[model samples]
Target: MTETVFQEESEVESLLSPLRSFLKCSTPKEWVEEAKKEKNLPTLLRDHLICELKAAQSAMLLIRRYAVDEESGKALLNWLKPYEDFTYRLVGDWRKLADYSSFNKRMVPKSRRPYSQPLIDKMVLLIKEELHHFYQVLEIAEELGIKYDKITSSRYARSLLSHVRTYEPAALIDKLICGAYIEARSCERFAAVAPHLTAKLSTFYYSLLRSEARHYQDYLALAREISDNDISERIAYFGEIEKELIQSSDDDFKFHSGLPC
Candidate 1:
């Protein structure tokens, strides 16, 4: 490898190390092997496109539910409308989506909630980046001659979310921690599969590492900020759940799926 290549690899490892330690386990070799297969590329990209949109939608929900005022919430919905239409209704030109990823609306946080601004700030940026990534994944799929098709979601996110507490504040905090695990796992999988993909795809995946790493941190920081008490025990509790979900066998094999059975 050239000096530049070596330096890039070094940077990639530097980014992944803390993520590896943050999660209870790495992506299983079996899942990586399955994800890198040629037959799985279309499925992988399709699921990835949806995952990106879902991540954006999830962040949008956080802003709407916990922080933003009514008009801001409506603006957030409008911001995502085109992307949602394309994903669910198949009603728009995917090529035109790049222009829609931005949101210029002024978001007013709910009064008297000190944490509202930070929550809105982090999730709004996350929503933008995730929507942009959704477009990029679509662009890559088009470049590869892979047509977009809807696929059933993996059980991963639902299962993690099933454990969320039902009460206020605690529920929100749990969801944020869940967000952290989800983002961390996504970053880990991107690194695990990048090396096995085509050069162009590898480069794209590698480019996402920094943003994804920061996203997980953002989620964790917000979780800490929102809670009055220490959440270390809760963080560890979810880590074990996330680890099991990654290591267990599954018939389904989407982007965030567990080991392929």
Candidate 2:
């Protein structure tokens, strides 16, 4: 296990190299110490599972609103039903969650735009990956005897969403930038906490770094492609907000919450 772990870490170093350069911020060390405690593992897992499902759902929203035809929209709904029912309704157990898989990739009409297809394709990939991650998290939680529980959301995402512009194209651009920051921060946090976890959990977290890294890049790329003006200012503004959210005091020790108070 020791030798295998070393090789895995070595392989991910190339992935992490660019990850370090992509973000303007880091996860606070205080949060890491709080997250690494044995008592907090269950809370972390529960929050993470919610985060994964939310990521997939958010992507689904983007595709349905801007890209999919009516039939494809219905298909997307069917795809999400089992995952949502399990997470929100408590209608299914861990075994059922583990069994649920696959998302229909059928192409249909998109809200007309030159960049529409690229947006649809990237978001579909992200949604599929995020949902798969949700299942993986559930499996890990089951193995650790951690049951899913409803959690009040952290201010992290809402704060960012609250700042989104209220106009067309601009609104969409801001949303994509927000998505990028969220994915980048999640990747950063996973790397931050991995070393402090049990070897098994650590391996899982590190394994996520690559996909998370790419998700952020995909979002940023789309944002750039769709925008008519320079978005660097907006990105900088949100980066500052995201950094504050990460560094601020919070009573909750959620997966993406601020410094534990």
Candidate 3:
């Protein structure tokens, strides 16, 4: 049985080969062991659901801030209203966030530049997928009898976010790179813990791996598309920062945290 599961894990790792190459480092063994503990699964799922919501919100921010005109900005807010309502106000049903209908057709961009539509398209898809994942996670939490209690932000994201550049295109590029790292790490963690989960949970996490992998790719692709110069140097720089965050000590035991101090 162990050998069979190991073989399955190997296959999953093979599927993540692109992410492995794109990321500067692997998730540490200590963190993997920490994540695999049965007791940690609820906290992991709770934080993971929050992470998904944040991911969608992050993408929406990019669209609203960088790409959308004022009218479209209001539409964007309308799109996000249900999710935020469920999350913050808890005034609406979670099913409200599950809708994926069309927004306004006139998503006028601030500029007619080549990268605008690509960013809008990619981020829109990401928002849809991440929101769906968030709802799915809510379902999982319900099944497992885990309440959606609040969790403190993990150091991993804040550590990288603190380094975002203050300029125009560079700021955008940095955000894209950061997005790629977060998605890649999430995919890595899902694989690391899936085998240790109950079959139902394991299947759900595995189902998400492919979409998360593509999200990283989409972010990377957009980064490369927007940059005039080669982004390798910037990619390498962010990779180092990400590696440091993962390799160093962390106090929190949330998803994507480093080995606990």
Per-candidate TM equals 0.98, 0.93, 0.92
Where is model 1 more than 4 Å wrong at Cα?
A: none
What's the candidate order when arranged by decreasing lDDT? 1, 3, 2
Q: What tens digits encode model 3's per-residue C-alpha lDDT throughout 1-261?
A: 699889877878776998899888888988888888878888898889889989988998998888878888788788877777777766676655556434545678787677878989999989888888898999888888887777777988888989999998999999999999999999988888788888998999998988999999999999999999899998889899999999999878998898777
Model 2 C-alpha lDDT versus the unseen true structure: 0.85
lDDT of 1 at 56: 92
Q: How many clashes does each candidate structure show, in the order listed?
A: 0, 0, 0
Q: What C-alpha lDDT, on a 0 to 100 scale, does residue 261 get in candidate 2?
A: 87
* Model 3: per-residue Cα lDDT at residue 160: 94
Which lDDT tens digits does candidate 1 get at residues 180-206?
Answer: 999999999999999999999999999
Candidate RMSDs in Å, in order, are 0.8, 2.0, 2.6
- Once all C-alphas are superposed, what RMSD does model 1 give against the true structure? 0.8
Q: What C-alpha lDDT does candidate 3 achieve relative to the native structure?
A: 0.86
Candidate 3: give the clashing pairs.
none
- Model-by-model lDDT, in order? 0.94, 0.85, 0.86
Ranking 1 against 3 by TM-score, winner: 1
**By descending TM-score, how would the candidates be arranged?**
1, 2, 3
